[model samples]
Target: MPSKFGFIYHEDFLKYNFGKGHPLNSIRIQMHKELLELNSFFNNPNIKLISTKPCSDEDLLTVHTRDYIEFIRKLSETGVGSVDDKDTPAFKNMFEIAKTAVGGTITAVDEVMNGSILHAWNPGGGFHHAKQDSGGGFCIFNDIAIAIKRLIKKYNLQRILYLDIDAHHGNGVQEIFYDDSRVFKISLHESGETLYPHSGFEDETGIGDGEGYNINIPLPIGTFDEAYIHIIYQILPLIAEFYNPQFIVLAAGADAHFLDPLSHLQLTSTTYIRIAELVHGLSHKYCGGKCVLLGAGGYSLNATPRIWSLIVSKIAEVELKDEIPVEWRSKYNEYFNENNAPIRVVDDNPPKIDPERYKKISKYVDEITNRVKENIFMLYGFFKLIK
Candidate 1:
């Protein structure tokens, strides 16, 4: 039997750090790995730790233009100025680090597509904001798009499902595959009006051949677990049944969590676990368990790791201890000094929604769900699934 899960990691992933004050710190990735270690998650016989190297230019050129690649190369050499809009800084050897991050994602795809693993997670991957001609939104390379392009080129796979639960819209990936029907992109995120990369609106479905292939369910602010999970279940199962995707790519952004500093979705570990379970089942049902999970956005050092760990636990079929390890907490406190370090592996007291607020959110989600059903479901001839 194949390994159940492949976790792609590289030490240089830590080198992807932007700066001291930047919210996108690499230490959280380290914390996630160490927390899994402390919890004995890696000791399972079916779990394999995979290493990666920098992706070649050929792989990057699959999605990025030559000029943009050269621009990044020059900036990395000089180590001066920002990669894009000052959100991502240009550092010495930054190109190499970004390439390695992309490489890790490719490695995860290789492991899964080769049948060496049923599932994989690249915590360093999911730089979904990077476009072909420029990098921004804290992304230097479009790793997600490159990986999808590789699947199309190398594996000749069609009907690839790209599900992004990131707080922000997967703008780059959506744009790159916007006119292609081979890839089906669905993004559920905080409303672009309220967040960065302000896109992913309901009307921004897709264009040309990709019309109705791309789906965006932008949620209202203060969306909690019940409303979030309800929208997920209502949409994804129907999509799986209709699209029958051959591969699944998930950009799992934990920033939707209530504690996260960036986005305002107000989710908790409850929603993450349900998402993991749903995606895992969908992959097995339609794609023979071929799935890749990529770390996207999560600002809170405390909640992000815990949320990721919770997803991994579900995918790897391992039961995690409710209480975070005492020793791991000590290590976390020692290194990060995060006052909000999680004491439990899952949220104990998730943010409670006020009754009036929940009413508005529920109504809004219901409207969004109906709009998506009418817009995209019709293209798939999914009239019955609409209700």
Candidate 2:
């Protein structure tokens, strides 16, 4: 059978480094690829690995300002100064690498749209913190927004769904599509009051025709798998069914993992896989399996690779061993000079939250979920509600 899935990747993708000690190291991409290789994901006939070219200026201009684009290009050539207020820095040839990241995601979109593949993944994309004229949070280009614009303009399709499960809010993507009714953007992120960019709240729904099109579910810090999974299962299916989207775009960031130092949301590999499975099922049920997955923020060297590998394996319909491949583990130990590299794909059990506190947090989350459903779903004619 022809391949049903495409994996957009290239060696040059590893060049989008933000320098030493930056949280968004490109090495995590290599680690994920190596883990997948060790699991023999490449041997599957239904999955194809794809290489992509840099996006042209015109393609980028569809979402970013010409001045911002030129600024990045100039910095890339000169190798001086920071790109944003502070968090995102300019690296040598960063302009080209960022363009390639955008191009990789656009390429995946094309594969899915043309019927060459039912689903596609670009581990190099999902720089959701970048905006039209600036970059932030270690992101140089808003790949997710640009690709969504391309899909709408090229295909003339309406009702696209953008789902972000990253630890931080997808403020860039939300801002880009805030006034557009055709794209429905939903983000489940750590509360902006506690995270970077600090803006995704329950009340930031869209304006004008785009009103009720944008949904944000901001969870409190230290949220665990049970509450996280419950909120997703309750709201996502209802939204997908009501929207009846033409395509689904997911920003599958692994920074929410408990081991990640940047964020406090307590998720694990098991929850990550379940989230992927839920999204995959939704794609097939609503959009003929036309789903595009993009990599977002994931900082923990140990958790990031394993989380992404689980997502890829789930997408490829392959079974993976719980134990990390011995060769990969040994290599990790030698490279990091640490003898305590994880020996298994899954994380050790996360500590339990205090019972009274857990109950209070769950109640708050449920209230937020109900508020979203009430405010948005009623506009879409979903009256039953999740009580």
Candidate 3:
């Protein structure tokens, strides 16, 4: 019997590390693996562990230019240069690791389309900020875009939905597919006014035939779980129902959590689980449960691993205790020299947002949501009942 869930991972994934102090550390990936291992998730008969091979040059060219690819290759060989202005640096073998990440995502898509699994997750993928000519935000290759292109060409997929919940905008993915009507991109993130890459405004609906196919909901800073959930529940289902995509790709970033160092959203582990549940439910309803989840930008070491663990558990339909495994906690404590590692999977208490502040944020989110609905939803005939 085939497994219901497939997880793509390789030890080589740890080679994508940016250095000791960089926010995009690969240690978080290892920690997530440890958490799942503590729970014996790999031993489950319904879950399959998959390995990844580096994608070929042809695969890279699907979304990147040959000149840019050569630049990255030379930088990787030298092992000492910044790939972009600053955020992404060229470490030893950077090109190979980034290529492997792309391959992992493509492999996940193949598994889903071939009926090997109903769903898949790649913890080392989701380099969504990289563009055709350059890398940014610690991303060397836009794996999500390359995988989408491969899916369209290999399987002749007509309608594919790319949903991003990263705290920062998925500008690269949106840009790559901006003029393609067959792929719809929806991103919910902190307003660009306060985040990096500084794009994904509500007005960036699309271009030419792709107009209205691109949807962005820019939430205000300090937005809490309740408000976030409200916006998600209101917008996602309607879009999924209207688009009726053949497949769903989710960029699940943990940076929006209150404990994260990078962004100003107040989401908790519970919020992560809820978001995953919503995406999982939507995939089942509209795409026959053919969804691929990718890890994106989450900086806080303690919070990121736990948040991702919740997402994996949700997809695998496994229940883990609230308490973290004692042995794992001790090991991480020894490794990080932090005695305060969380012993429980879920946050003990929800991060509190002032009622008045939450109201203000909620109103702002409503305005953006309404603007998106009026601008894009109407074009798709989804506005009839929304208004």
Candidate 4:
């Protein structure tokens, strides 16, 4: 029997490379794939492997402007100019890579909608910072928005929940959906006050009919594993209670790991698995285990693969003991001398928590969960009063 657990991955996705020193380089994707193949969960009878073609111009236009699409096309053909903030230089084929990424996401959404899969993972998609007409944060297309457009048009799913945990805010996604009442965009990220592509503020919930539908839980620097769990513990139930979405998407970024060079969040491998478990529980409870996972930001090659391996293990219902693979580290050694990449799945064997950091994070946990409880009560009263 075909399974609802499917994966959308491609060798060609590696062509979307951002060059040396860039965090969004192709190696991250490659390393993640390598680690995934090392596990047998994907070979399970219930897991299906699939791939998708590039999105057509019409599909791309679902969330992007024609002019912006044209600009990318011309630049892609010419292989000239910079599509990202000077930091993300575009060589030839940048357009194809970005389009294919978006196509991969839509294909996953299409499969999920058609019941071809109960859950899907798109390693090349989730470029969440791109807007309708422009690129930002190394994201060339808002593939998330593209997927949402199709889900709404084809399936009429009125209540969609989007949860992002990238180190950076998903500004483009929030901007596109901020006005629509049918979709809710919630992000847990480094405070935009300190991060790049800054936007996800607490007060920026959806407006008009969509008011109070969106949520953002910005965190301070040095936020550790326990603290993030507290945030997710608080936000997930509260959001579930309030919006009641039948469809959900999570931007599972690995950059929040304590080892990542780009961000300050000190989340560990074990914590990531817990988050995946949370998502699994939420989907099972609210949407019959119907949710799609999008690969987002993660720069540390050494740390990123283990984080994803843990996630894939949960998604595919595989149980992995706390042991790292040897071949995996050998591969990492070939690619990285001492810098980004790592040979083993997770360094330090087991991730450790500084006693002081845990204490601080614990404080934040209490604050966020308590605040959310207050709002939930207030909303309960307001709705009951209106009734």
Candidate 5:
């Protein structure tokens, strides 16, 4: 199965783990690699496993402030405070851990940009909530933004599109490029009405020259797969036809799976794979086959690795012929309460799609999609008025 896809990985990434019992912990990364190896997936000769050097201070300065970088460096060495009001907590060595994660993403970006790979993936990246000088939501620096800056600077990329499918709104990423027209952001998440970070409203389009470049679809809790596929089909193609970016970054978060403990969204593993395929196809169609993928949130003990496995297999286009690996399951049995861990290739049954919730979300999706269409027309009329 030797192929052209590139994967970003390094052993140092696991050292950045939060202390034991944190929701975002080190076990997730270890298990993902273990499953790939146990199943003979990464053994394919076509896929290249790589370790990238840490991004330099100049790289960090592109999207992060100098004072913030210095503060983080000192704090990483010795700090015992919280980085956010909730979620991201400060601890010793926070700087090195966060920096390594940012560097992993940069390495992925550089691989794709330099013609070494067509697509690159870094499961340790996607720290979307950190602002230029501040940390929040368990994120210390904005990896996606740093990568975007690198692309723009080195390649002179004119337009970049960021699509976040995480359960939480990407308020930090959205605010980072709020006034930069070269970036177009679209986020589909559990509406702030019920989720954390509580931003991403319909009217919060881009400002100034970036006006209308940012798009947000805040969904209600409990929405399921079919509704997700239908609405995304509509909007994604429209985005492909409209913004036409040079490349797209997918903030593909698996926590939206129904089994995840973090949020109330009810999507299944299949949905994650389908979205990955769509993003890959759209990138090829519009962005010259260049795509950068990042893993975000997923917390269900049994579901996290399975959902990610499905996504990786689909995006990487590898076929699986059998059942779950015994060694991998045995290791996590105690941690997962034994009975609740994934024991088969896929879940025994599809997640409950909740008809009532699906209907409500369809209504919301239809209304919003139509309004976006209508607003495009209204803008045209305004241009005529000025003339």
Candidate 6:
């Protein structure tokens, strides 16, 4: 009998840190782990707390180029210079730390597939922005891609669904599997026009055998929970049903929250729960709950932990008190020095978007959703052309 859920963690995950004042802080991961512990979420018999180890160069070679792997190794030795140009700053032992992060996800996939656990979440994984030969968006290794490749190789599974909701598009993963039909990739992000790595346009659907397997939904600025959830609820289930994936990999980035400094989307905690619920349902419905989730991107020290906690609670079917634990709050204050630590597990209300602004956003979302239906959904025979 498999446990209901597994949460992967490692103290070395904190070493994946970039530097002071960097947006991709590792402390949030620690805060989330401590929060769950303080809340007694781990005491449940159905939940398992799993330790992680580092992946080898051979494992990384499954998705990255050999020359690029050597480059990261040499850069890690120097402990100076960035991985690409600016975003990914290299540090001593960075290659080793990144390999550990990738290993966390791989272990999660193995655990789920081998029936040790029904589902798993690797807080250190989800480096979707890392390309084959270079890094970007603070991502050093494309762990999501590597894990997917490992799934196909080890389990002989086809029809894997890679869903990314990081405020930024998953350009690196899309680029790697752009022409491959075995993977169906969907990214819902803040429009690339106003964000970094300016791509993920609606028309960037896949080509050749991969045509229509790639889906991108670029939301305009000021997108609130109503519009955000509406798009997800409308599109995700239909695609999952049609794809009937044998495994699911989710890049559940918390940066889409309204409190996050990195993106313009205004999602509250409710939307995160809704997403977890939908994904949990889809996994059981399509893949025997063989799913691995990765914490891809989220910058808000205050909101990110709570958002992740909520998602984890939902997945484990564990109920939590709304109040933040006093001991955890003390630790948070000491680490972050911010007075505005979240007081509750969930946000009280969704932010209000200006009516006119929301109207424009709704129109744009409809257009994008309709375009996806016509382009991607039609390819799966989920939509029909009307004359």
For model 1, what is the error of residue 63's alpha carbon versus the real structure, in angstroms, after optimal superposition? 0.5
- What lDDT tens digits, residue by residue, belong to model 4 across residues 53-142? 888888888889999988888888877788864666676887888888888888888888888788888888888888988887888888
Q: Which sections of candidate 1 miss by over 4 Å?
A: 1-3, 334-340, 382-387
lDDT of 2 by residue, 179-218 (tens): 9989999999999999988899988899987888999999
Model 3 TM: 0.96
TM-score to native of every candidate shown = 0.96, 0.96, 0.96, 0.93, 0.93, 0.96
At residue 153, what lDDT does model 2 achieve?
96
Better of 3 and 5 by lDDT: 3
Score candidate 5 by TM-score against the native. Answer: 0.93
Q: Report the Cα RMSD per candidate.
A: 2.4, 2.6, 2.4, 2.4, 2.3, 2.3
Candidate 2 regions exceeding 4 Å error are: 1-3, 334-338, 382-387
lDDT of 6 by residue, 185-256 (tens): 999999999998799988888998888889999888888887888888988888887888998899999999
Judging by lDDT against the true structure, name the best candidate: 1
Candidate 6: the clashing residue pairs are none
Model 2 worst lDDT run, 10 consecutive residues: 378-387
Worst 10 residues of 4 by lDDT: 338-347
The residue pairs found clashing in candidate 2 are none
- Cα-lDDT of candidate 1: 0.90
Q: After superposition, how far is residue 70 of candidate 3 from its true place, in Å?
A: 0.2
- Residue pairs with colliding backbones in model 3 are none
lDDT for 203 (candidate 4): 74
Off by over 4 Å in 6: 1-3, 334-338, 382-387
RMSD of candidate 1 to the truth, in angstroms, is 2.4
**lDDT value for model 4:** 0.79
